[model samples]
Each structure stands twice: as structure tokens, then as C-alpha cells.
Target: MVISSDSQRDLFSDTGALGFVQILLAEMHDDLLGKVARFRQLTDLSKTLGPGGTMIHGGEVAYTAWTEARNSFIHGNYIATVMLCQSLAENLLAAYIDTDLEAEKLPKRVSFNDTIRRCVSKGVFDKSFSGELITMMNIRNPLSHYRDLEDPSNLSRRVLDSRLPAIAHLMGDASFALAIAIKLLSLPPFWLSGETLK
Candidate 1:
């Protein structure tokens, strides 16, 4: 799929925002301002990637919904915002499964990273792609389950650094985790092909 690099607005990195979570949440909702359009973009990708008639998981759609609700939460949409955290968690895994089905041949059972690795092992993606997916998938757990925001060592940064080199500026932030999550879905399988995953 041909995607426009400029389609996603850089809300957190460009706005000079202070709070990572608050700013990112706000940016997702500010479609008119063009601060960032990650929610819209990811949703579109999820649909496009599943064009083959396979049933895409609700979790994938929920994750995109959580991203949208996060913005609404900032604007006092309490009902929607209250549930985004958990919804996002479910979505992440769902999206992973959707990616699994995209493969020409799929394994019977595997985790999100392993599923991606299987694709790489088939020469669909290079070994480095598996490593990156593993790192990002590993990080998603802490990001989804953690409660304290004060701690600087969060998984989102590690995942982002693995994908987007520019995110190195804020490697300890959890809010950007969603951005990384969506980024994982955005990348094409072709870009990751070449090396063995092991």
C-alpha cells in the first residue's frame, strides 16, 4: 500500500508540548488543527491490511478507538476516556493477529512478535524486522499494565527508538507508546524482508 508520509501530523514532537500523555491525547482529537492524525491513519491501515475478507479482530479497532478516546478524555469525555487504557491493550494484540493473517502461510499458534518473526523467517522480512517487532511487543506489556507515570523507564520509548529514530529525544515516556503501536501496524511487510529472524 502506498502511504503518504505527511499524512500523520507530528503532534507531540512538533507542538513543543510538556506532558507526554496529555499532549498526545489532545493532539489526536485536534484533527482540524492538524496536530496529528495517528488515530485516523492507524484505523485506515487496519482496514486496508485486512482487505482479503478475513475477519479483523475487534481489539484492533478498539485500540484505534482508545487513541481517539484518549483525546476525548482530555476534553472531558469521561465515559470514553475512562476505558481507553484497557481498550488499547486489547487492540494492540488484536492488531498483531491481523498482521499474522496477512502472511502467505501462517503458523498454528504464536505470540505477536513470534507471528511477525514467522513472516520474516519466510523471507518476507529481514531478521532485524523480527527483532524490532519483538522489542516493541515486549514493551507493550509494561506500557499497558503499569500504573505509575513518574518512572522514566517505560517501554514505549524503547519501541519507538526501534522504529522511529527521531523518538530518541524522549525515550522514557509512556504516552508515546501508542504512537509506536500504530507505527508498527503502518510498516509494510516488504520493508522488513531480507534477513533471517534468528
Candidate 2:
């Protein structure tokens, strides 16, 4: 059954849905007492960000991006995972550069690329790491915007439009996206900066 995009199906689709879910749950149940999961770092941001009252408003985006990105990865929404990771990195850099590290308005017309450049200039991240951030943008670019199929760098052609299988490419890219998010979230300046600038 193909549900149309406009369709609004109830969460409880049918009476048997609950029974099916219960069976699936039992199948997935793990008896292990301890299992270190890869999803932990990508799940929370408020703890890392600290006492609330952002550098500017809307810092909460970073929190949501992490959760959604993790969900996207685990659910096989690889494209969304890649895109959200890039967005998370950009927002973090913007937070650091917004209003001289104070709770002031972010400057006007600062592009995402410029936000990264500013972070490097302010010594927020070294020149080497600047390339890492840029790499995030590059990976996300094809997903975010249209790319010519003739171009060798077009990710859609490489991942979706191909006659051959591209699942491995997509899975690898999503994993790489998570790795980038983990590194950015773990950065001292980002996690320790908190909401206030002192």
C-alpha cells in the first residue's frame, strides 16, 4: 500500500498494528546488560551547551539537529543525516561568531561559508580544521542544491541516478557525517561556551 504524500494516516493505523509492533519489539529486545552505543554523542546538546539563554535566540536548533541527524542515520535517511550534520556545524560556528561572543545579534549577511571562515580567523578552529568543516559543506552540497549530472562531483549521480548499486556510498557518507558531528560537538569551545559569553 503506497500512502500518498498528502495522506494523513493516524498513528494507530489498525487493530493488528499493536500486535505487530509488540512482536517486533520482542524480536529486537537485547539481553545484554551494557552496550556502548554510537548514537549517544549525537543524541543530546543541552548538556553540552549548558545553562540556557543562548548567545542569541534559536540556539535550540543545534539540539534538534543532533537528534534528527542521528535518527536520520539510524533509519537509513542518509541524505538527511548528511544535510543536518552540515547544518549543525554551521550553526555552531555561527554561535561562536555571533556578536563578538556576546549575547548580541549575529551580524547581517554572513553566509554559512563566511561563518566558517570567521571561525578560523578568530582562532576558534585551526586552518587544518577549517578544511574539515569545508568538507562537510562539500559532502552536503549536492544534497542541498541541484548539481549537473555532467559534473563529476554531483553526489546524486553518484548515489541515486546510477544504474549500479549505490547503497554503500550512501551508507559511508552518512557515517562520515556522524563522525563530523561528533567531532564538532566534542569541541571544547562549543560544548563549554554554554549560553552566556563572559
Candidate 3:
């Protein structure tokens, strides 16, 4: 994504604004680098674990979704970013569950809330971590449904408190959610030999 020449000039015309934008851009760049590094680590870990064919495919899908989510966040599509993050989380949770149980044993289609609840009940994730996933999913709802903004039931207090107010805040929230998704996805299943999965 190249910044347009006009936009670049506008940013540079104001000394203070330029400084602030530069700082934000630098931080975003660093975050992208960190994500790349962690992705490489996850790839190496997957290789060592020698996950099955199904796991390998699921990892690829989850990674692709994660990358798209990051790009969306960078482009300031906050709602799309949040939605993609939620999808990534669901994909990871489903992959983990499938690793231990047969596909037929699971629900045909699981919602994000159901996925988190199932994972927590099965001990695949801790209650607190699952709570965070739930929080993230809750935040996605308002962005996903326009009417949710008017419905008090769909709006979450925590999300309202940490709502994206600016580019920096949006990036920060998206980055944090993406980080959580990546961490969960990178956790190799316990069934894999050689390393004991936490």
C-alpha cells in the first residue's frame, strides 16, 4: 500500500502532525515486523511438531485470515479487521477441537460464542483467555450488525469503553486482538509428540 503523493504532502506540510503520523507509522511498522517474526516461529514450530495433513491445511487458512485482518486494520477498515480477527479465532479453535475429536462429534456450524464455550469446557483454553476471546467477539458484533448499535443487548460496555476513536486507537485494538488470535493458533495440540502442549 503506497501512500498517495497528495496525502504524503499534506502529512509533511504540518510539522507537528507529520511527527505524530511518523510515530504512528513507525509503531505500525514495528507491529507488522513482530507479526512476521512470530509467524515464522509458528511455521518452525509446526514443522517440528509434524502436524497432520488436516492441521497443516487449517494453519494455512488461519494464517491467511490473520494476514488479511492485519492488512484491513492497517488500511483503517476497523470493522472488517475485527470481523476477520473473530474468524481467525474461530478457525483456530475449530482446528484445535478437531485435532482431539472427530468432526462428526462437533456441531455442523459453530458460532464464535459457541466455539469459545466449547473450547473452555473441553479445557482447550483457560477461562480467562476464553473470556478475552468472548470480549473480542462481543466487540465484533456491533461492527458486524448496524442495528446492534441501537440495541443495548448487542452492545458491550467493555467495548464501548475501549472503542476505536482514532487511527492509533483502532490500530492498537486490532493489533491486540490479532496478537491474541495468533497466540491461540500457534499453540500446537497436545496430541503432537515430542513437545507437551500447554
Candidate 4:
């Protein structure tokens, strides 16, 4: 029986989904563990955390999301894809700041505008730096789902149109999500500025 392209795509896509997660996990493995260890070192060195630190809490949350995503993917649970995508997004965002750092130091919200603004405040990114993170989230959402979108390519194109240039500027012609993740990792939580800046 000849497999329709859609069916072929579905099979291929499911495989790709797993591959994407695996690659993401691999790329993040050292970084994530290193960050956790570093956070402990920073806390020990500073001796300045108050009774409550969102960074510590955020680390726990990131770990929880990671576990759920990992378990779902390993068990072949359908929702694993979505959970993993969200986990990736959340961890990427959390990595933008010191997990043990103060929350007030960050913007009250997590928007593209807020991220850029915060970066500028830190003297890292300039105000002219701009991109639409929400748009990328939409693209990620559908890709994480099993239902066929009306026009996946169109959606992908739209995200590319909005975010590709900014991404290329940062990561040299990478996908928007990757660019964002790279930028996030390079910043406070990972603090491997010199390594990733180039």
C-alpha cells in the first residue's frame, strides 16, 4: 500500500519529534547540570539569599518540567511532545536569569519586549534588539501536537519571517527557538558569555 505523504509525514514527524527532543536534551545536558552546580557555588560564595528566592524556586520548577517531559517521551505518551516543548521554553526563559537571583530583578512578565528590555538593563543587549517570542510559541505549539494544522508551512514561514533575521544576528542563521535558547543560555544562569557570544 502506498503511504500518503501526510501519513508518511506523520510517521516521519513523530520520529523527528523524538529526535528533536533527544537533540535538545543532549545539547542541554551539560549546561543544565553545570548551571545547577554553579548556582550552589554562587549561593555558597555570596551568602546573600533571603528567605525567599525565585531563582531557587525556578530551578525546582525547571527540574520538574524536565522530568515530566522526559518521562512522557520515554513512555511514548502523546502529551510528552507538548510538555517537552513547554519545558524547553520555560527552561530557556529561566536560564535568562540567575535561578538564585532575585525576581524583582527581572520583569514581572516574560514577553519578547520584557526579555529585550531586561537584557538592555543588564548592559548586554541593546534596545534595538527586537523579536516576537509569542509568534514562535505558536509555531512550537502546533509542531508539538498530532492534529494536522491547516498550513504548517505557512505557519513556519510566518515565524521565520518574523524571527529569522534576529536569530541569524545572534546565532548565525539558526532557528528562532534555538537562537532564543542560545541567547538565554549565554546569559546569567549559564554565564558562559565569552563562549557563546562568539
- Please name the candidate that would achieve the greatest lDDT relative to the true structure: 2
lDDT of each: 0.45, 0.67, 0.64, 0.45
How far off is residue 134 in model 4, in Å? 7.6
Candidate 3 segments exceeding 4 Å error: 1-61, 102-104, 148-169, 188-198
lDDT string for model 1 (1-198, tens) is: 755657555422563446777878775566453323433543554453322322213445664665565465334343333244335434444354456645554345434555555556656457775565555444444544673444443434544546644233223222333344334444453133335569
lDDT of predicted model 1: 0.45
Q: Per-residue error at 116 for model 2, in Å?
A: 1.0
TM-score of each predicted structure versus truth: 0.34, 0.65, 0.55, 0.33
Q: Please give the lDDT score at residue 194 for candidate 4.
A: 32
Q: What's the distance in Å from true for residue 162, model 2?
A: 9.9
Residue by residue across 85-131, what tens digits does model 3's lDDT show?
A: 88888887777676675433557787777777777788777899888
Per-residue lDDT tens digits for candidate 2, residues 1-198, read 987655745643555878898977774464222112434434543344324323322278877887788777766678889988887877767866774744445566567877877777777778887788787788788777887987665864775556545666766777788887776666656544334456
Looking at model 3, the pairs that clash are none
Q: If both were scored by TM-score, which would come out higher, candidate 2 or candidate 4?
A: 2
| Alpha-carbon shift of residue 25 in model 2 (angstroms) | 6.1
Please say which candidate is ahead in lDDT: 1 or 2.
Answer: 2
Q: In model 1, what is the error at residue 162, expressed in angstroms?
A: 20
